[model samples]
Target: MIKVEQLSFSFPQKELYTNISFTLEEGQHCAFIGTSGSGKSTLIDILMDPDRYLFDGRLEMEPGCSIGYVSQFAQPDTSADTTVFEYIGASFIKLQNEIESICSEMETSSDIEPLLDKYQLALDAFDAMGGNDFESNIHKQLNLANLMKRRDLKVSDLSGGEFKLVQVMKEMLNRPDLMIMDEPDVFLDFDNLNALKQLINSHKGILLVVTHNRYLLNHCFNKIIHLENMEIQEYDGRYIEYNFSLLQTKIELQELTLAEKEEIERNENIIDNLRAIATYNSEASRGRALKARVKFQERLEARRIKAPFVDIKQPEIHFGIDHDVQDLTVLKVDQYRAAYDELLLDKVSFEMKSTDKVALIGPNGTGKTTLLRDIANNHPDSITLHADAKVAYLSQLQGEVLKDSNTLLEEFIDAGMSTYDEIRAHLAGYGFEREILNQRIESLSGGEKNLLQLAKVAVSNADLLLLDEPTSHLDTYTQIALDQAIQDYKGAILMISHDFYSVVNGMDYVLIIDDKTVRRMTIKKFKKMIYARHFDKDYLELEQQKKALETKIELALKATDFELAQSLMDELEALIKLL
Candidate 1:
């Protein structure tokens, strides 16, 4: 349906892509992935409206094909009073109305030929869109998303995450030739994420999705378009299989590179010795041997492996604590009550001791953000902070903690702890370039802003950290880095997250907001809860075995023993069947 060949694009400050090429065929679900600030979203913009930008490329879409788009920050129009069902069926309704109007005009018009032609066009469009069963299709999508009860709800009344799902259903039901969704999984809860997976899997048309959610990456896409090192690579296979292929190739190339390095070093030593002997003996043969060794060394250096795919640079993220809180209780909340349009949280209580790591989790719009804010603000009646505790917060709404008008440099300098040069160096570690130091915070991608927030939190030296959905916009590599940072952090942390891997792996326990109150659940129970809801009954056990077998396979591959590797792969295949 769509093809891009040798596409190259750049901005004044940075060159994003150089000769990137890919294709989207019917029934292929493509996952567009890249590191934060790698211009995946920008590429989507180019695809959606090629005329808006001047670039070098051949971008072609078959004639008469239609495109559907969902932006990264799509929100329902609050001023509109459209119901969810009406919104989803808007396209079908419009065509139906046009056909009816044309028929009415035919009843009295003198130019009957044009009216008949218009009627035929409208009918064709409606039939192509499945208008005969549009309502049933809408209900089916809503039911699959578990939003049937909210079909009559105003689009303006839905939560942000719910509205995102509604947007997906609206676009999918329209049955456009190609659908492009940019980070549509952001801010969605566990159930919604699963629902999104189903929607992507069931989509029949061509799909190009920009996402970083591991679950979706594993389950949704059949093709991978990876943007890295100012280039693009396409893999016509599952992401898991593509990833394994990359790993295997990287391992082999690394071994070859290591051998080349040893040869170069040995040649260098021999060359030095030969030159020294030639200088002493004035021998022509010695000089010629030295020249030969030099050439060999140069050749080895030229052919050395540069594995961009495997050697992708990851942001260095470390949450450092200068000192530990001596207080037994770092924070405590009792009888906490908060409300917006209605009472969302009532009599909610929770506490965290020093060095404790806990996750605050609940459904979307369940006052998780409100409770985190109250704790950060130190509400006198219900929330308490120890006298010895110094707290730092990373808000889900990046704008709340950062000024849109300020430049990246100015924002960091406002902290009064680092000089201009020092701040620039620190931001570099978090993957910000010096050229964009004066760039406004508002211009950054969502992942970049979240990364900046993480950089700030890293330097706070606070003994208590409050993080809300820290992994929402981060790329997978950065997310894994954050998981490690959270695991290694010495301070007490109360984080609000819907990412199941982060919760089950990094957190000590979970503080679940249930029935407008707070309760604690062990990590084991939390794992069980997720496995039961999202996987087969035996999936958890089989997944564990698979991971172990994968580790053994990696070890065998590292030893360059294909026999052992194949044996482990067989075991893994059997375990995967159970999963």
Candidate 2:
């Protein structure tokens, strides 16, 4: 439990917050949602007391409460000579030591028996804290974080995703009263995202999470704290409530705009009357009226006015007319197989038309990227496409391209472009200002680098676009702009993305990958399948049975019924197999 009152913080150039107040109750799960650069991270740092930013606030925290924090870019302890098991098992060791020390003291002195009795509660507390399921939980989370395969490997050899998983596991092992996670879903795939959701849902402690993943936010959060315009506002309900509240705010803003317009007109009339008096040679009266007019004009200008939202302007794309390829297939793949001990894609075959806008969709690790690479490689003959068919690829790992030793502007010009002004203008459209345009490519953030790549691809006048997770680090507003740009492009597209809203709204065809096979379907048909699989009566019944079984297992463990726990676990495993 934590409470803040009259919080204020400011920087030299901008004020981030003023007179903010909020309370986070024990065992509450709250999400901080807002636009980029809106001070969400700043508030988190203030709460954690990491660095002394300019601030004036009274924070009342629960006495003796411990807080565990996981940052967005947490790196694994590579220098430590410890296994994953040893690291996670350390928590149990500490708990055991405390319990033993209390018992020893009680045995040595009769005066300590009452205190010893209080300490004796540790074992039950530990058990209730998921001590029995600790190993399973660690394994589950590691697998979800894409660290399971490397569990036996040293931390130094683990990938970014593995390091993130380890950090999450470490926070969970501490069993703190409150957990604060910033961008926990940054490097996670869909499987890990689901695992994280399940972990959070089952967790008993309070959680404050900051993430831009809509899927995670929609599924896990019950309360939303929206930070905007240097103010904090709370929504009593979940994601839906936050969204509806935003809509209401927009309506209120419209009404406010109308009232301000009327006020502006009134002020203009007063200024006109003052001018007429000045023309009639009434110097004293005119001067007094002019002063009044000037004061009113200043007040009107000082009022914070919201700029009217205008959609991003998409440039007219003309895929140069080279040749009529009505009969030529734009893409073709056959007998593609890739795997590490298991086939991820087995003998997949598909063809793409010049006009096809296909979306690749599946659960994580189902070989979406592998399939794309295979298609891109096998279609070399199709490369010399329609004279106007220039191809531009946007991969998830586009940051790798930024490793080149060139300034951002230099790279844009070197990529077959001619004009510096054109490059600067396009980069600015993607939120990069002139100062950033001259910076080295390696100095940019992931989001900025992504935007640069998109700008380059867009300017190439490519007729065929290949995008893989293009919207990962982008905010919702930017995503909408990108969607509009893609919609207006007079070219075909093959994209692999996890953003469901964009995929559903922009795609015309769906290609579902599952169990090493590919099935092409219309978007309408794919939607029907998803609806039936997730929301049908039979699926609901199955889900209810699964929940009941999970509850039974939890009760068995809490009761110290190991045999029952094992039985229930076995039954649950069988039920999962059936599903």
Candidate 3:
């Protein structure tokens, strides 16, 4: 078990968590969530190396507790030629290498006794670590993750998502007591995402995962640790349950607060009348009543409800266009072909309407990002655009759009904003504080950088937006905001995304990259394809029903039907458990 008490931390420029406390019991799988740049990853760093930080806290962990960490930005060395099987069995291989080295040394030198002892020790340790069955174990893990076919592939040859899964597999093979994965679900496709879910659910050790993947949050974790507004709210239940309870509490509190405000308004009106009458008639009783009412109003104001955690702040992301495209086809690609080390795209063709919201989806490493980038650049040989169309691109790699060394203020100014105050005011809407304006872009979190990218995209006033994995690093609320923005956008959008819900709910249809060609699929077919691949129809239908019930329950709570709301909530809970 791990326990923290009254933990408070701050940087020179910003305060993070304060007086926050939570405990991670032996078997809890906790999902850590918060706004972008709210220090979720920083908290994990502190946990991994408590002595590196100076903060007010009491953090206690069980003695001899082992930890395995999968960092968000960790990548396999491209220069290394290790295969997946060899990489996962590295420990066994290391022991084997040491034993072989000792035997070779004994043959060459007069250190036979010492070498034999070392070899025996190495053999014992290897056997104890199950190294004798290392190959079989590695193969079993590969099969479980459905990567047996790729077991012999070089780790560096894998896509980012595949490499991330390989990293998870490598860490899990170590069998640590606790595992902490930061944003492990970021670039994963549907099938790999399900594989991650299975890994998380099947792990016997503790897990503290930092992620905003709704699918994983719903399916993997039993606990939630939300860091928002410099406070921590830990829930000892599934994310859906915590979310439902939180929404219910927020609704009830908001209603009560609204009623209180109304009452206070009435009292203020009465107080003003009493004061007016007292001033005109000079009556002592009227003066006393006015004073009494004033005091009552103060008391009421003092008792106003403040639900900081529930009233979470969401970035205001809006994608706008200055004008509509005159032509029906905003973008067109015909017989487009591209290659990198190997053929990625071939004879791919697609066109986007002026108002089309299309998802460009395929498995990882299928040239989705490549295709989007090429279109955004308008490759002269293969792509064409409407005469009136202005394009804005948001790259999955933030660095493609944002300069790392530039400060936020400078970045926005360079993006065409004129003045500091104007830039500050614009960024404020995206939840960036004024103080962070001078912070370098590289210092920002992945979410913050993406938010900055979105903020930049919002001002481009382009009729065509090429968004590659726009929702990957964003928080759930910002993802929702983006979905709404996409829905409401008057411009054309060809979004490359792996987020299932975002694609299904936000896009009109999908342009799938299959067999080196682009094929248009209706939203219905897209959903069916996804459901067939990653989920069952029953589970999908149940999830849809669950969402409807949640909406109804919220409405019942708002209508002040306590009994009905309770019944609906109970039903929702049962449904959530089933899910």
lDDT of 3 by residue, 1-579 (tens): 888899999999899989999988888999999999889988899899999999898999888778999988888899999998888888889889998888888889875887788889999988877778778867777787888899989999988878888889888877778899999998888788888887888787889999999889888889999988888888999888888888778767877887898999999899878877876788787878888889999999999998877787777888887664454988889899889899999998878888888988888998888888887774757899888788899998888999999999999889899999899889999988777888999999999999899999999999989998899889988987887788788888888888887887788999887798888899888888777777755676687688678668768866877678778877887887777
Model 3 root mean square deviation, Cα atoms: 3.2
Write down the worst ten-residue block by lDDT for model 1: 538-547
Q: Give lDDT tens digits, candidate 1, residues 155-246.
A: 99998888999999999998889999999998898888888888888899999999999788878889999998888889998877776667
Distance from true location, Cα of 166 in model 2, Å: 7.9
Name the weakest run of 10 consecutive residues (lDDT summed) in model 3. 318-327
- Model 2 agreement with the true structure over 430-462: per-residue lDDT tens digits: 666656577677755455566677777776666
In model 2, where do residues sit more than 4 Å from their true spots?
3-22, 37-64, 70-90, 93-170, 186-192, 229-231, 304-328, 339-343, 371-388, 403-411, 416-420, 434-445, 532-579
Alpha carbon lDDT at 96, candidate 2: 71
Global local distance difference test of model 3: 0.86
Provide backbone clash counts, one per model: 0, 0, 0
Once model 1 is optimally superposed onto the true structure by TM-score, how far is the C-alpha of residue 1 displaced, in angstroms? 4.0
Q: Score candidate 3 by TM-score against the native.
A: 0.90
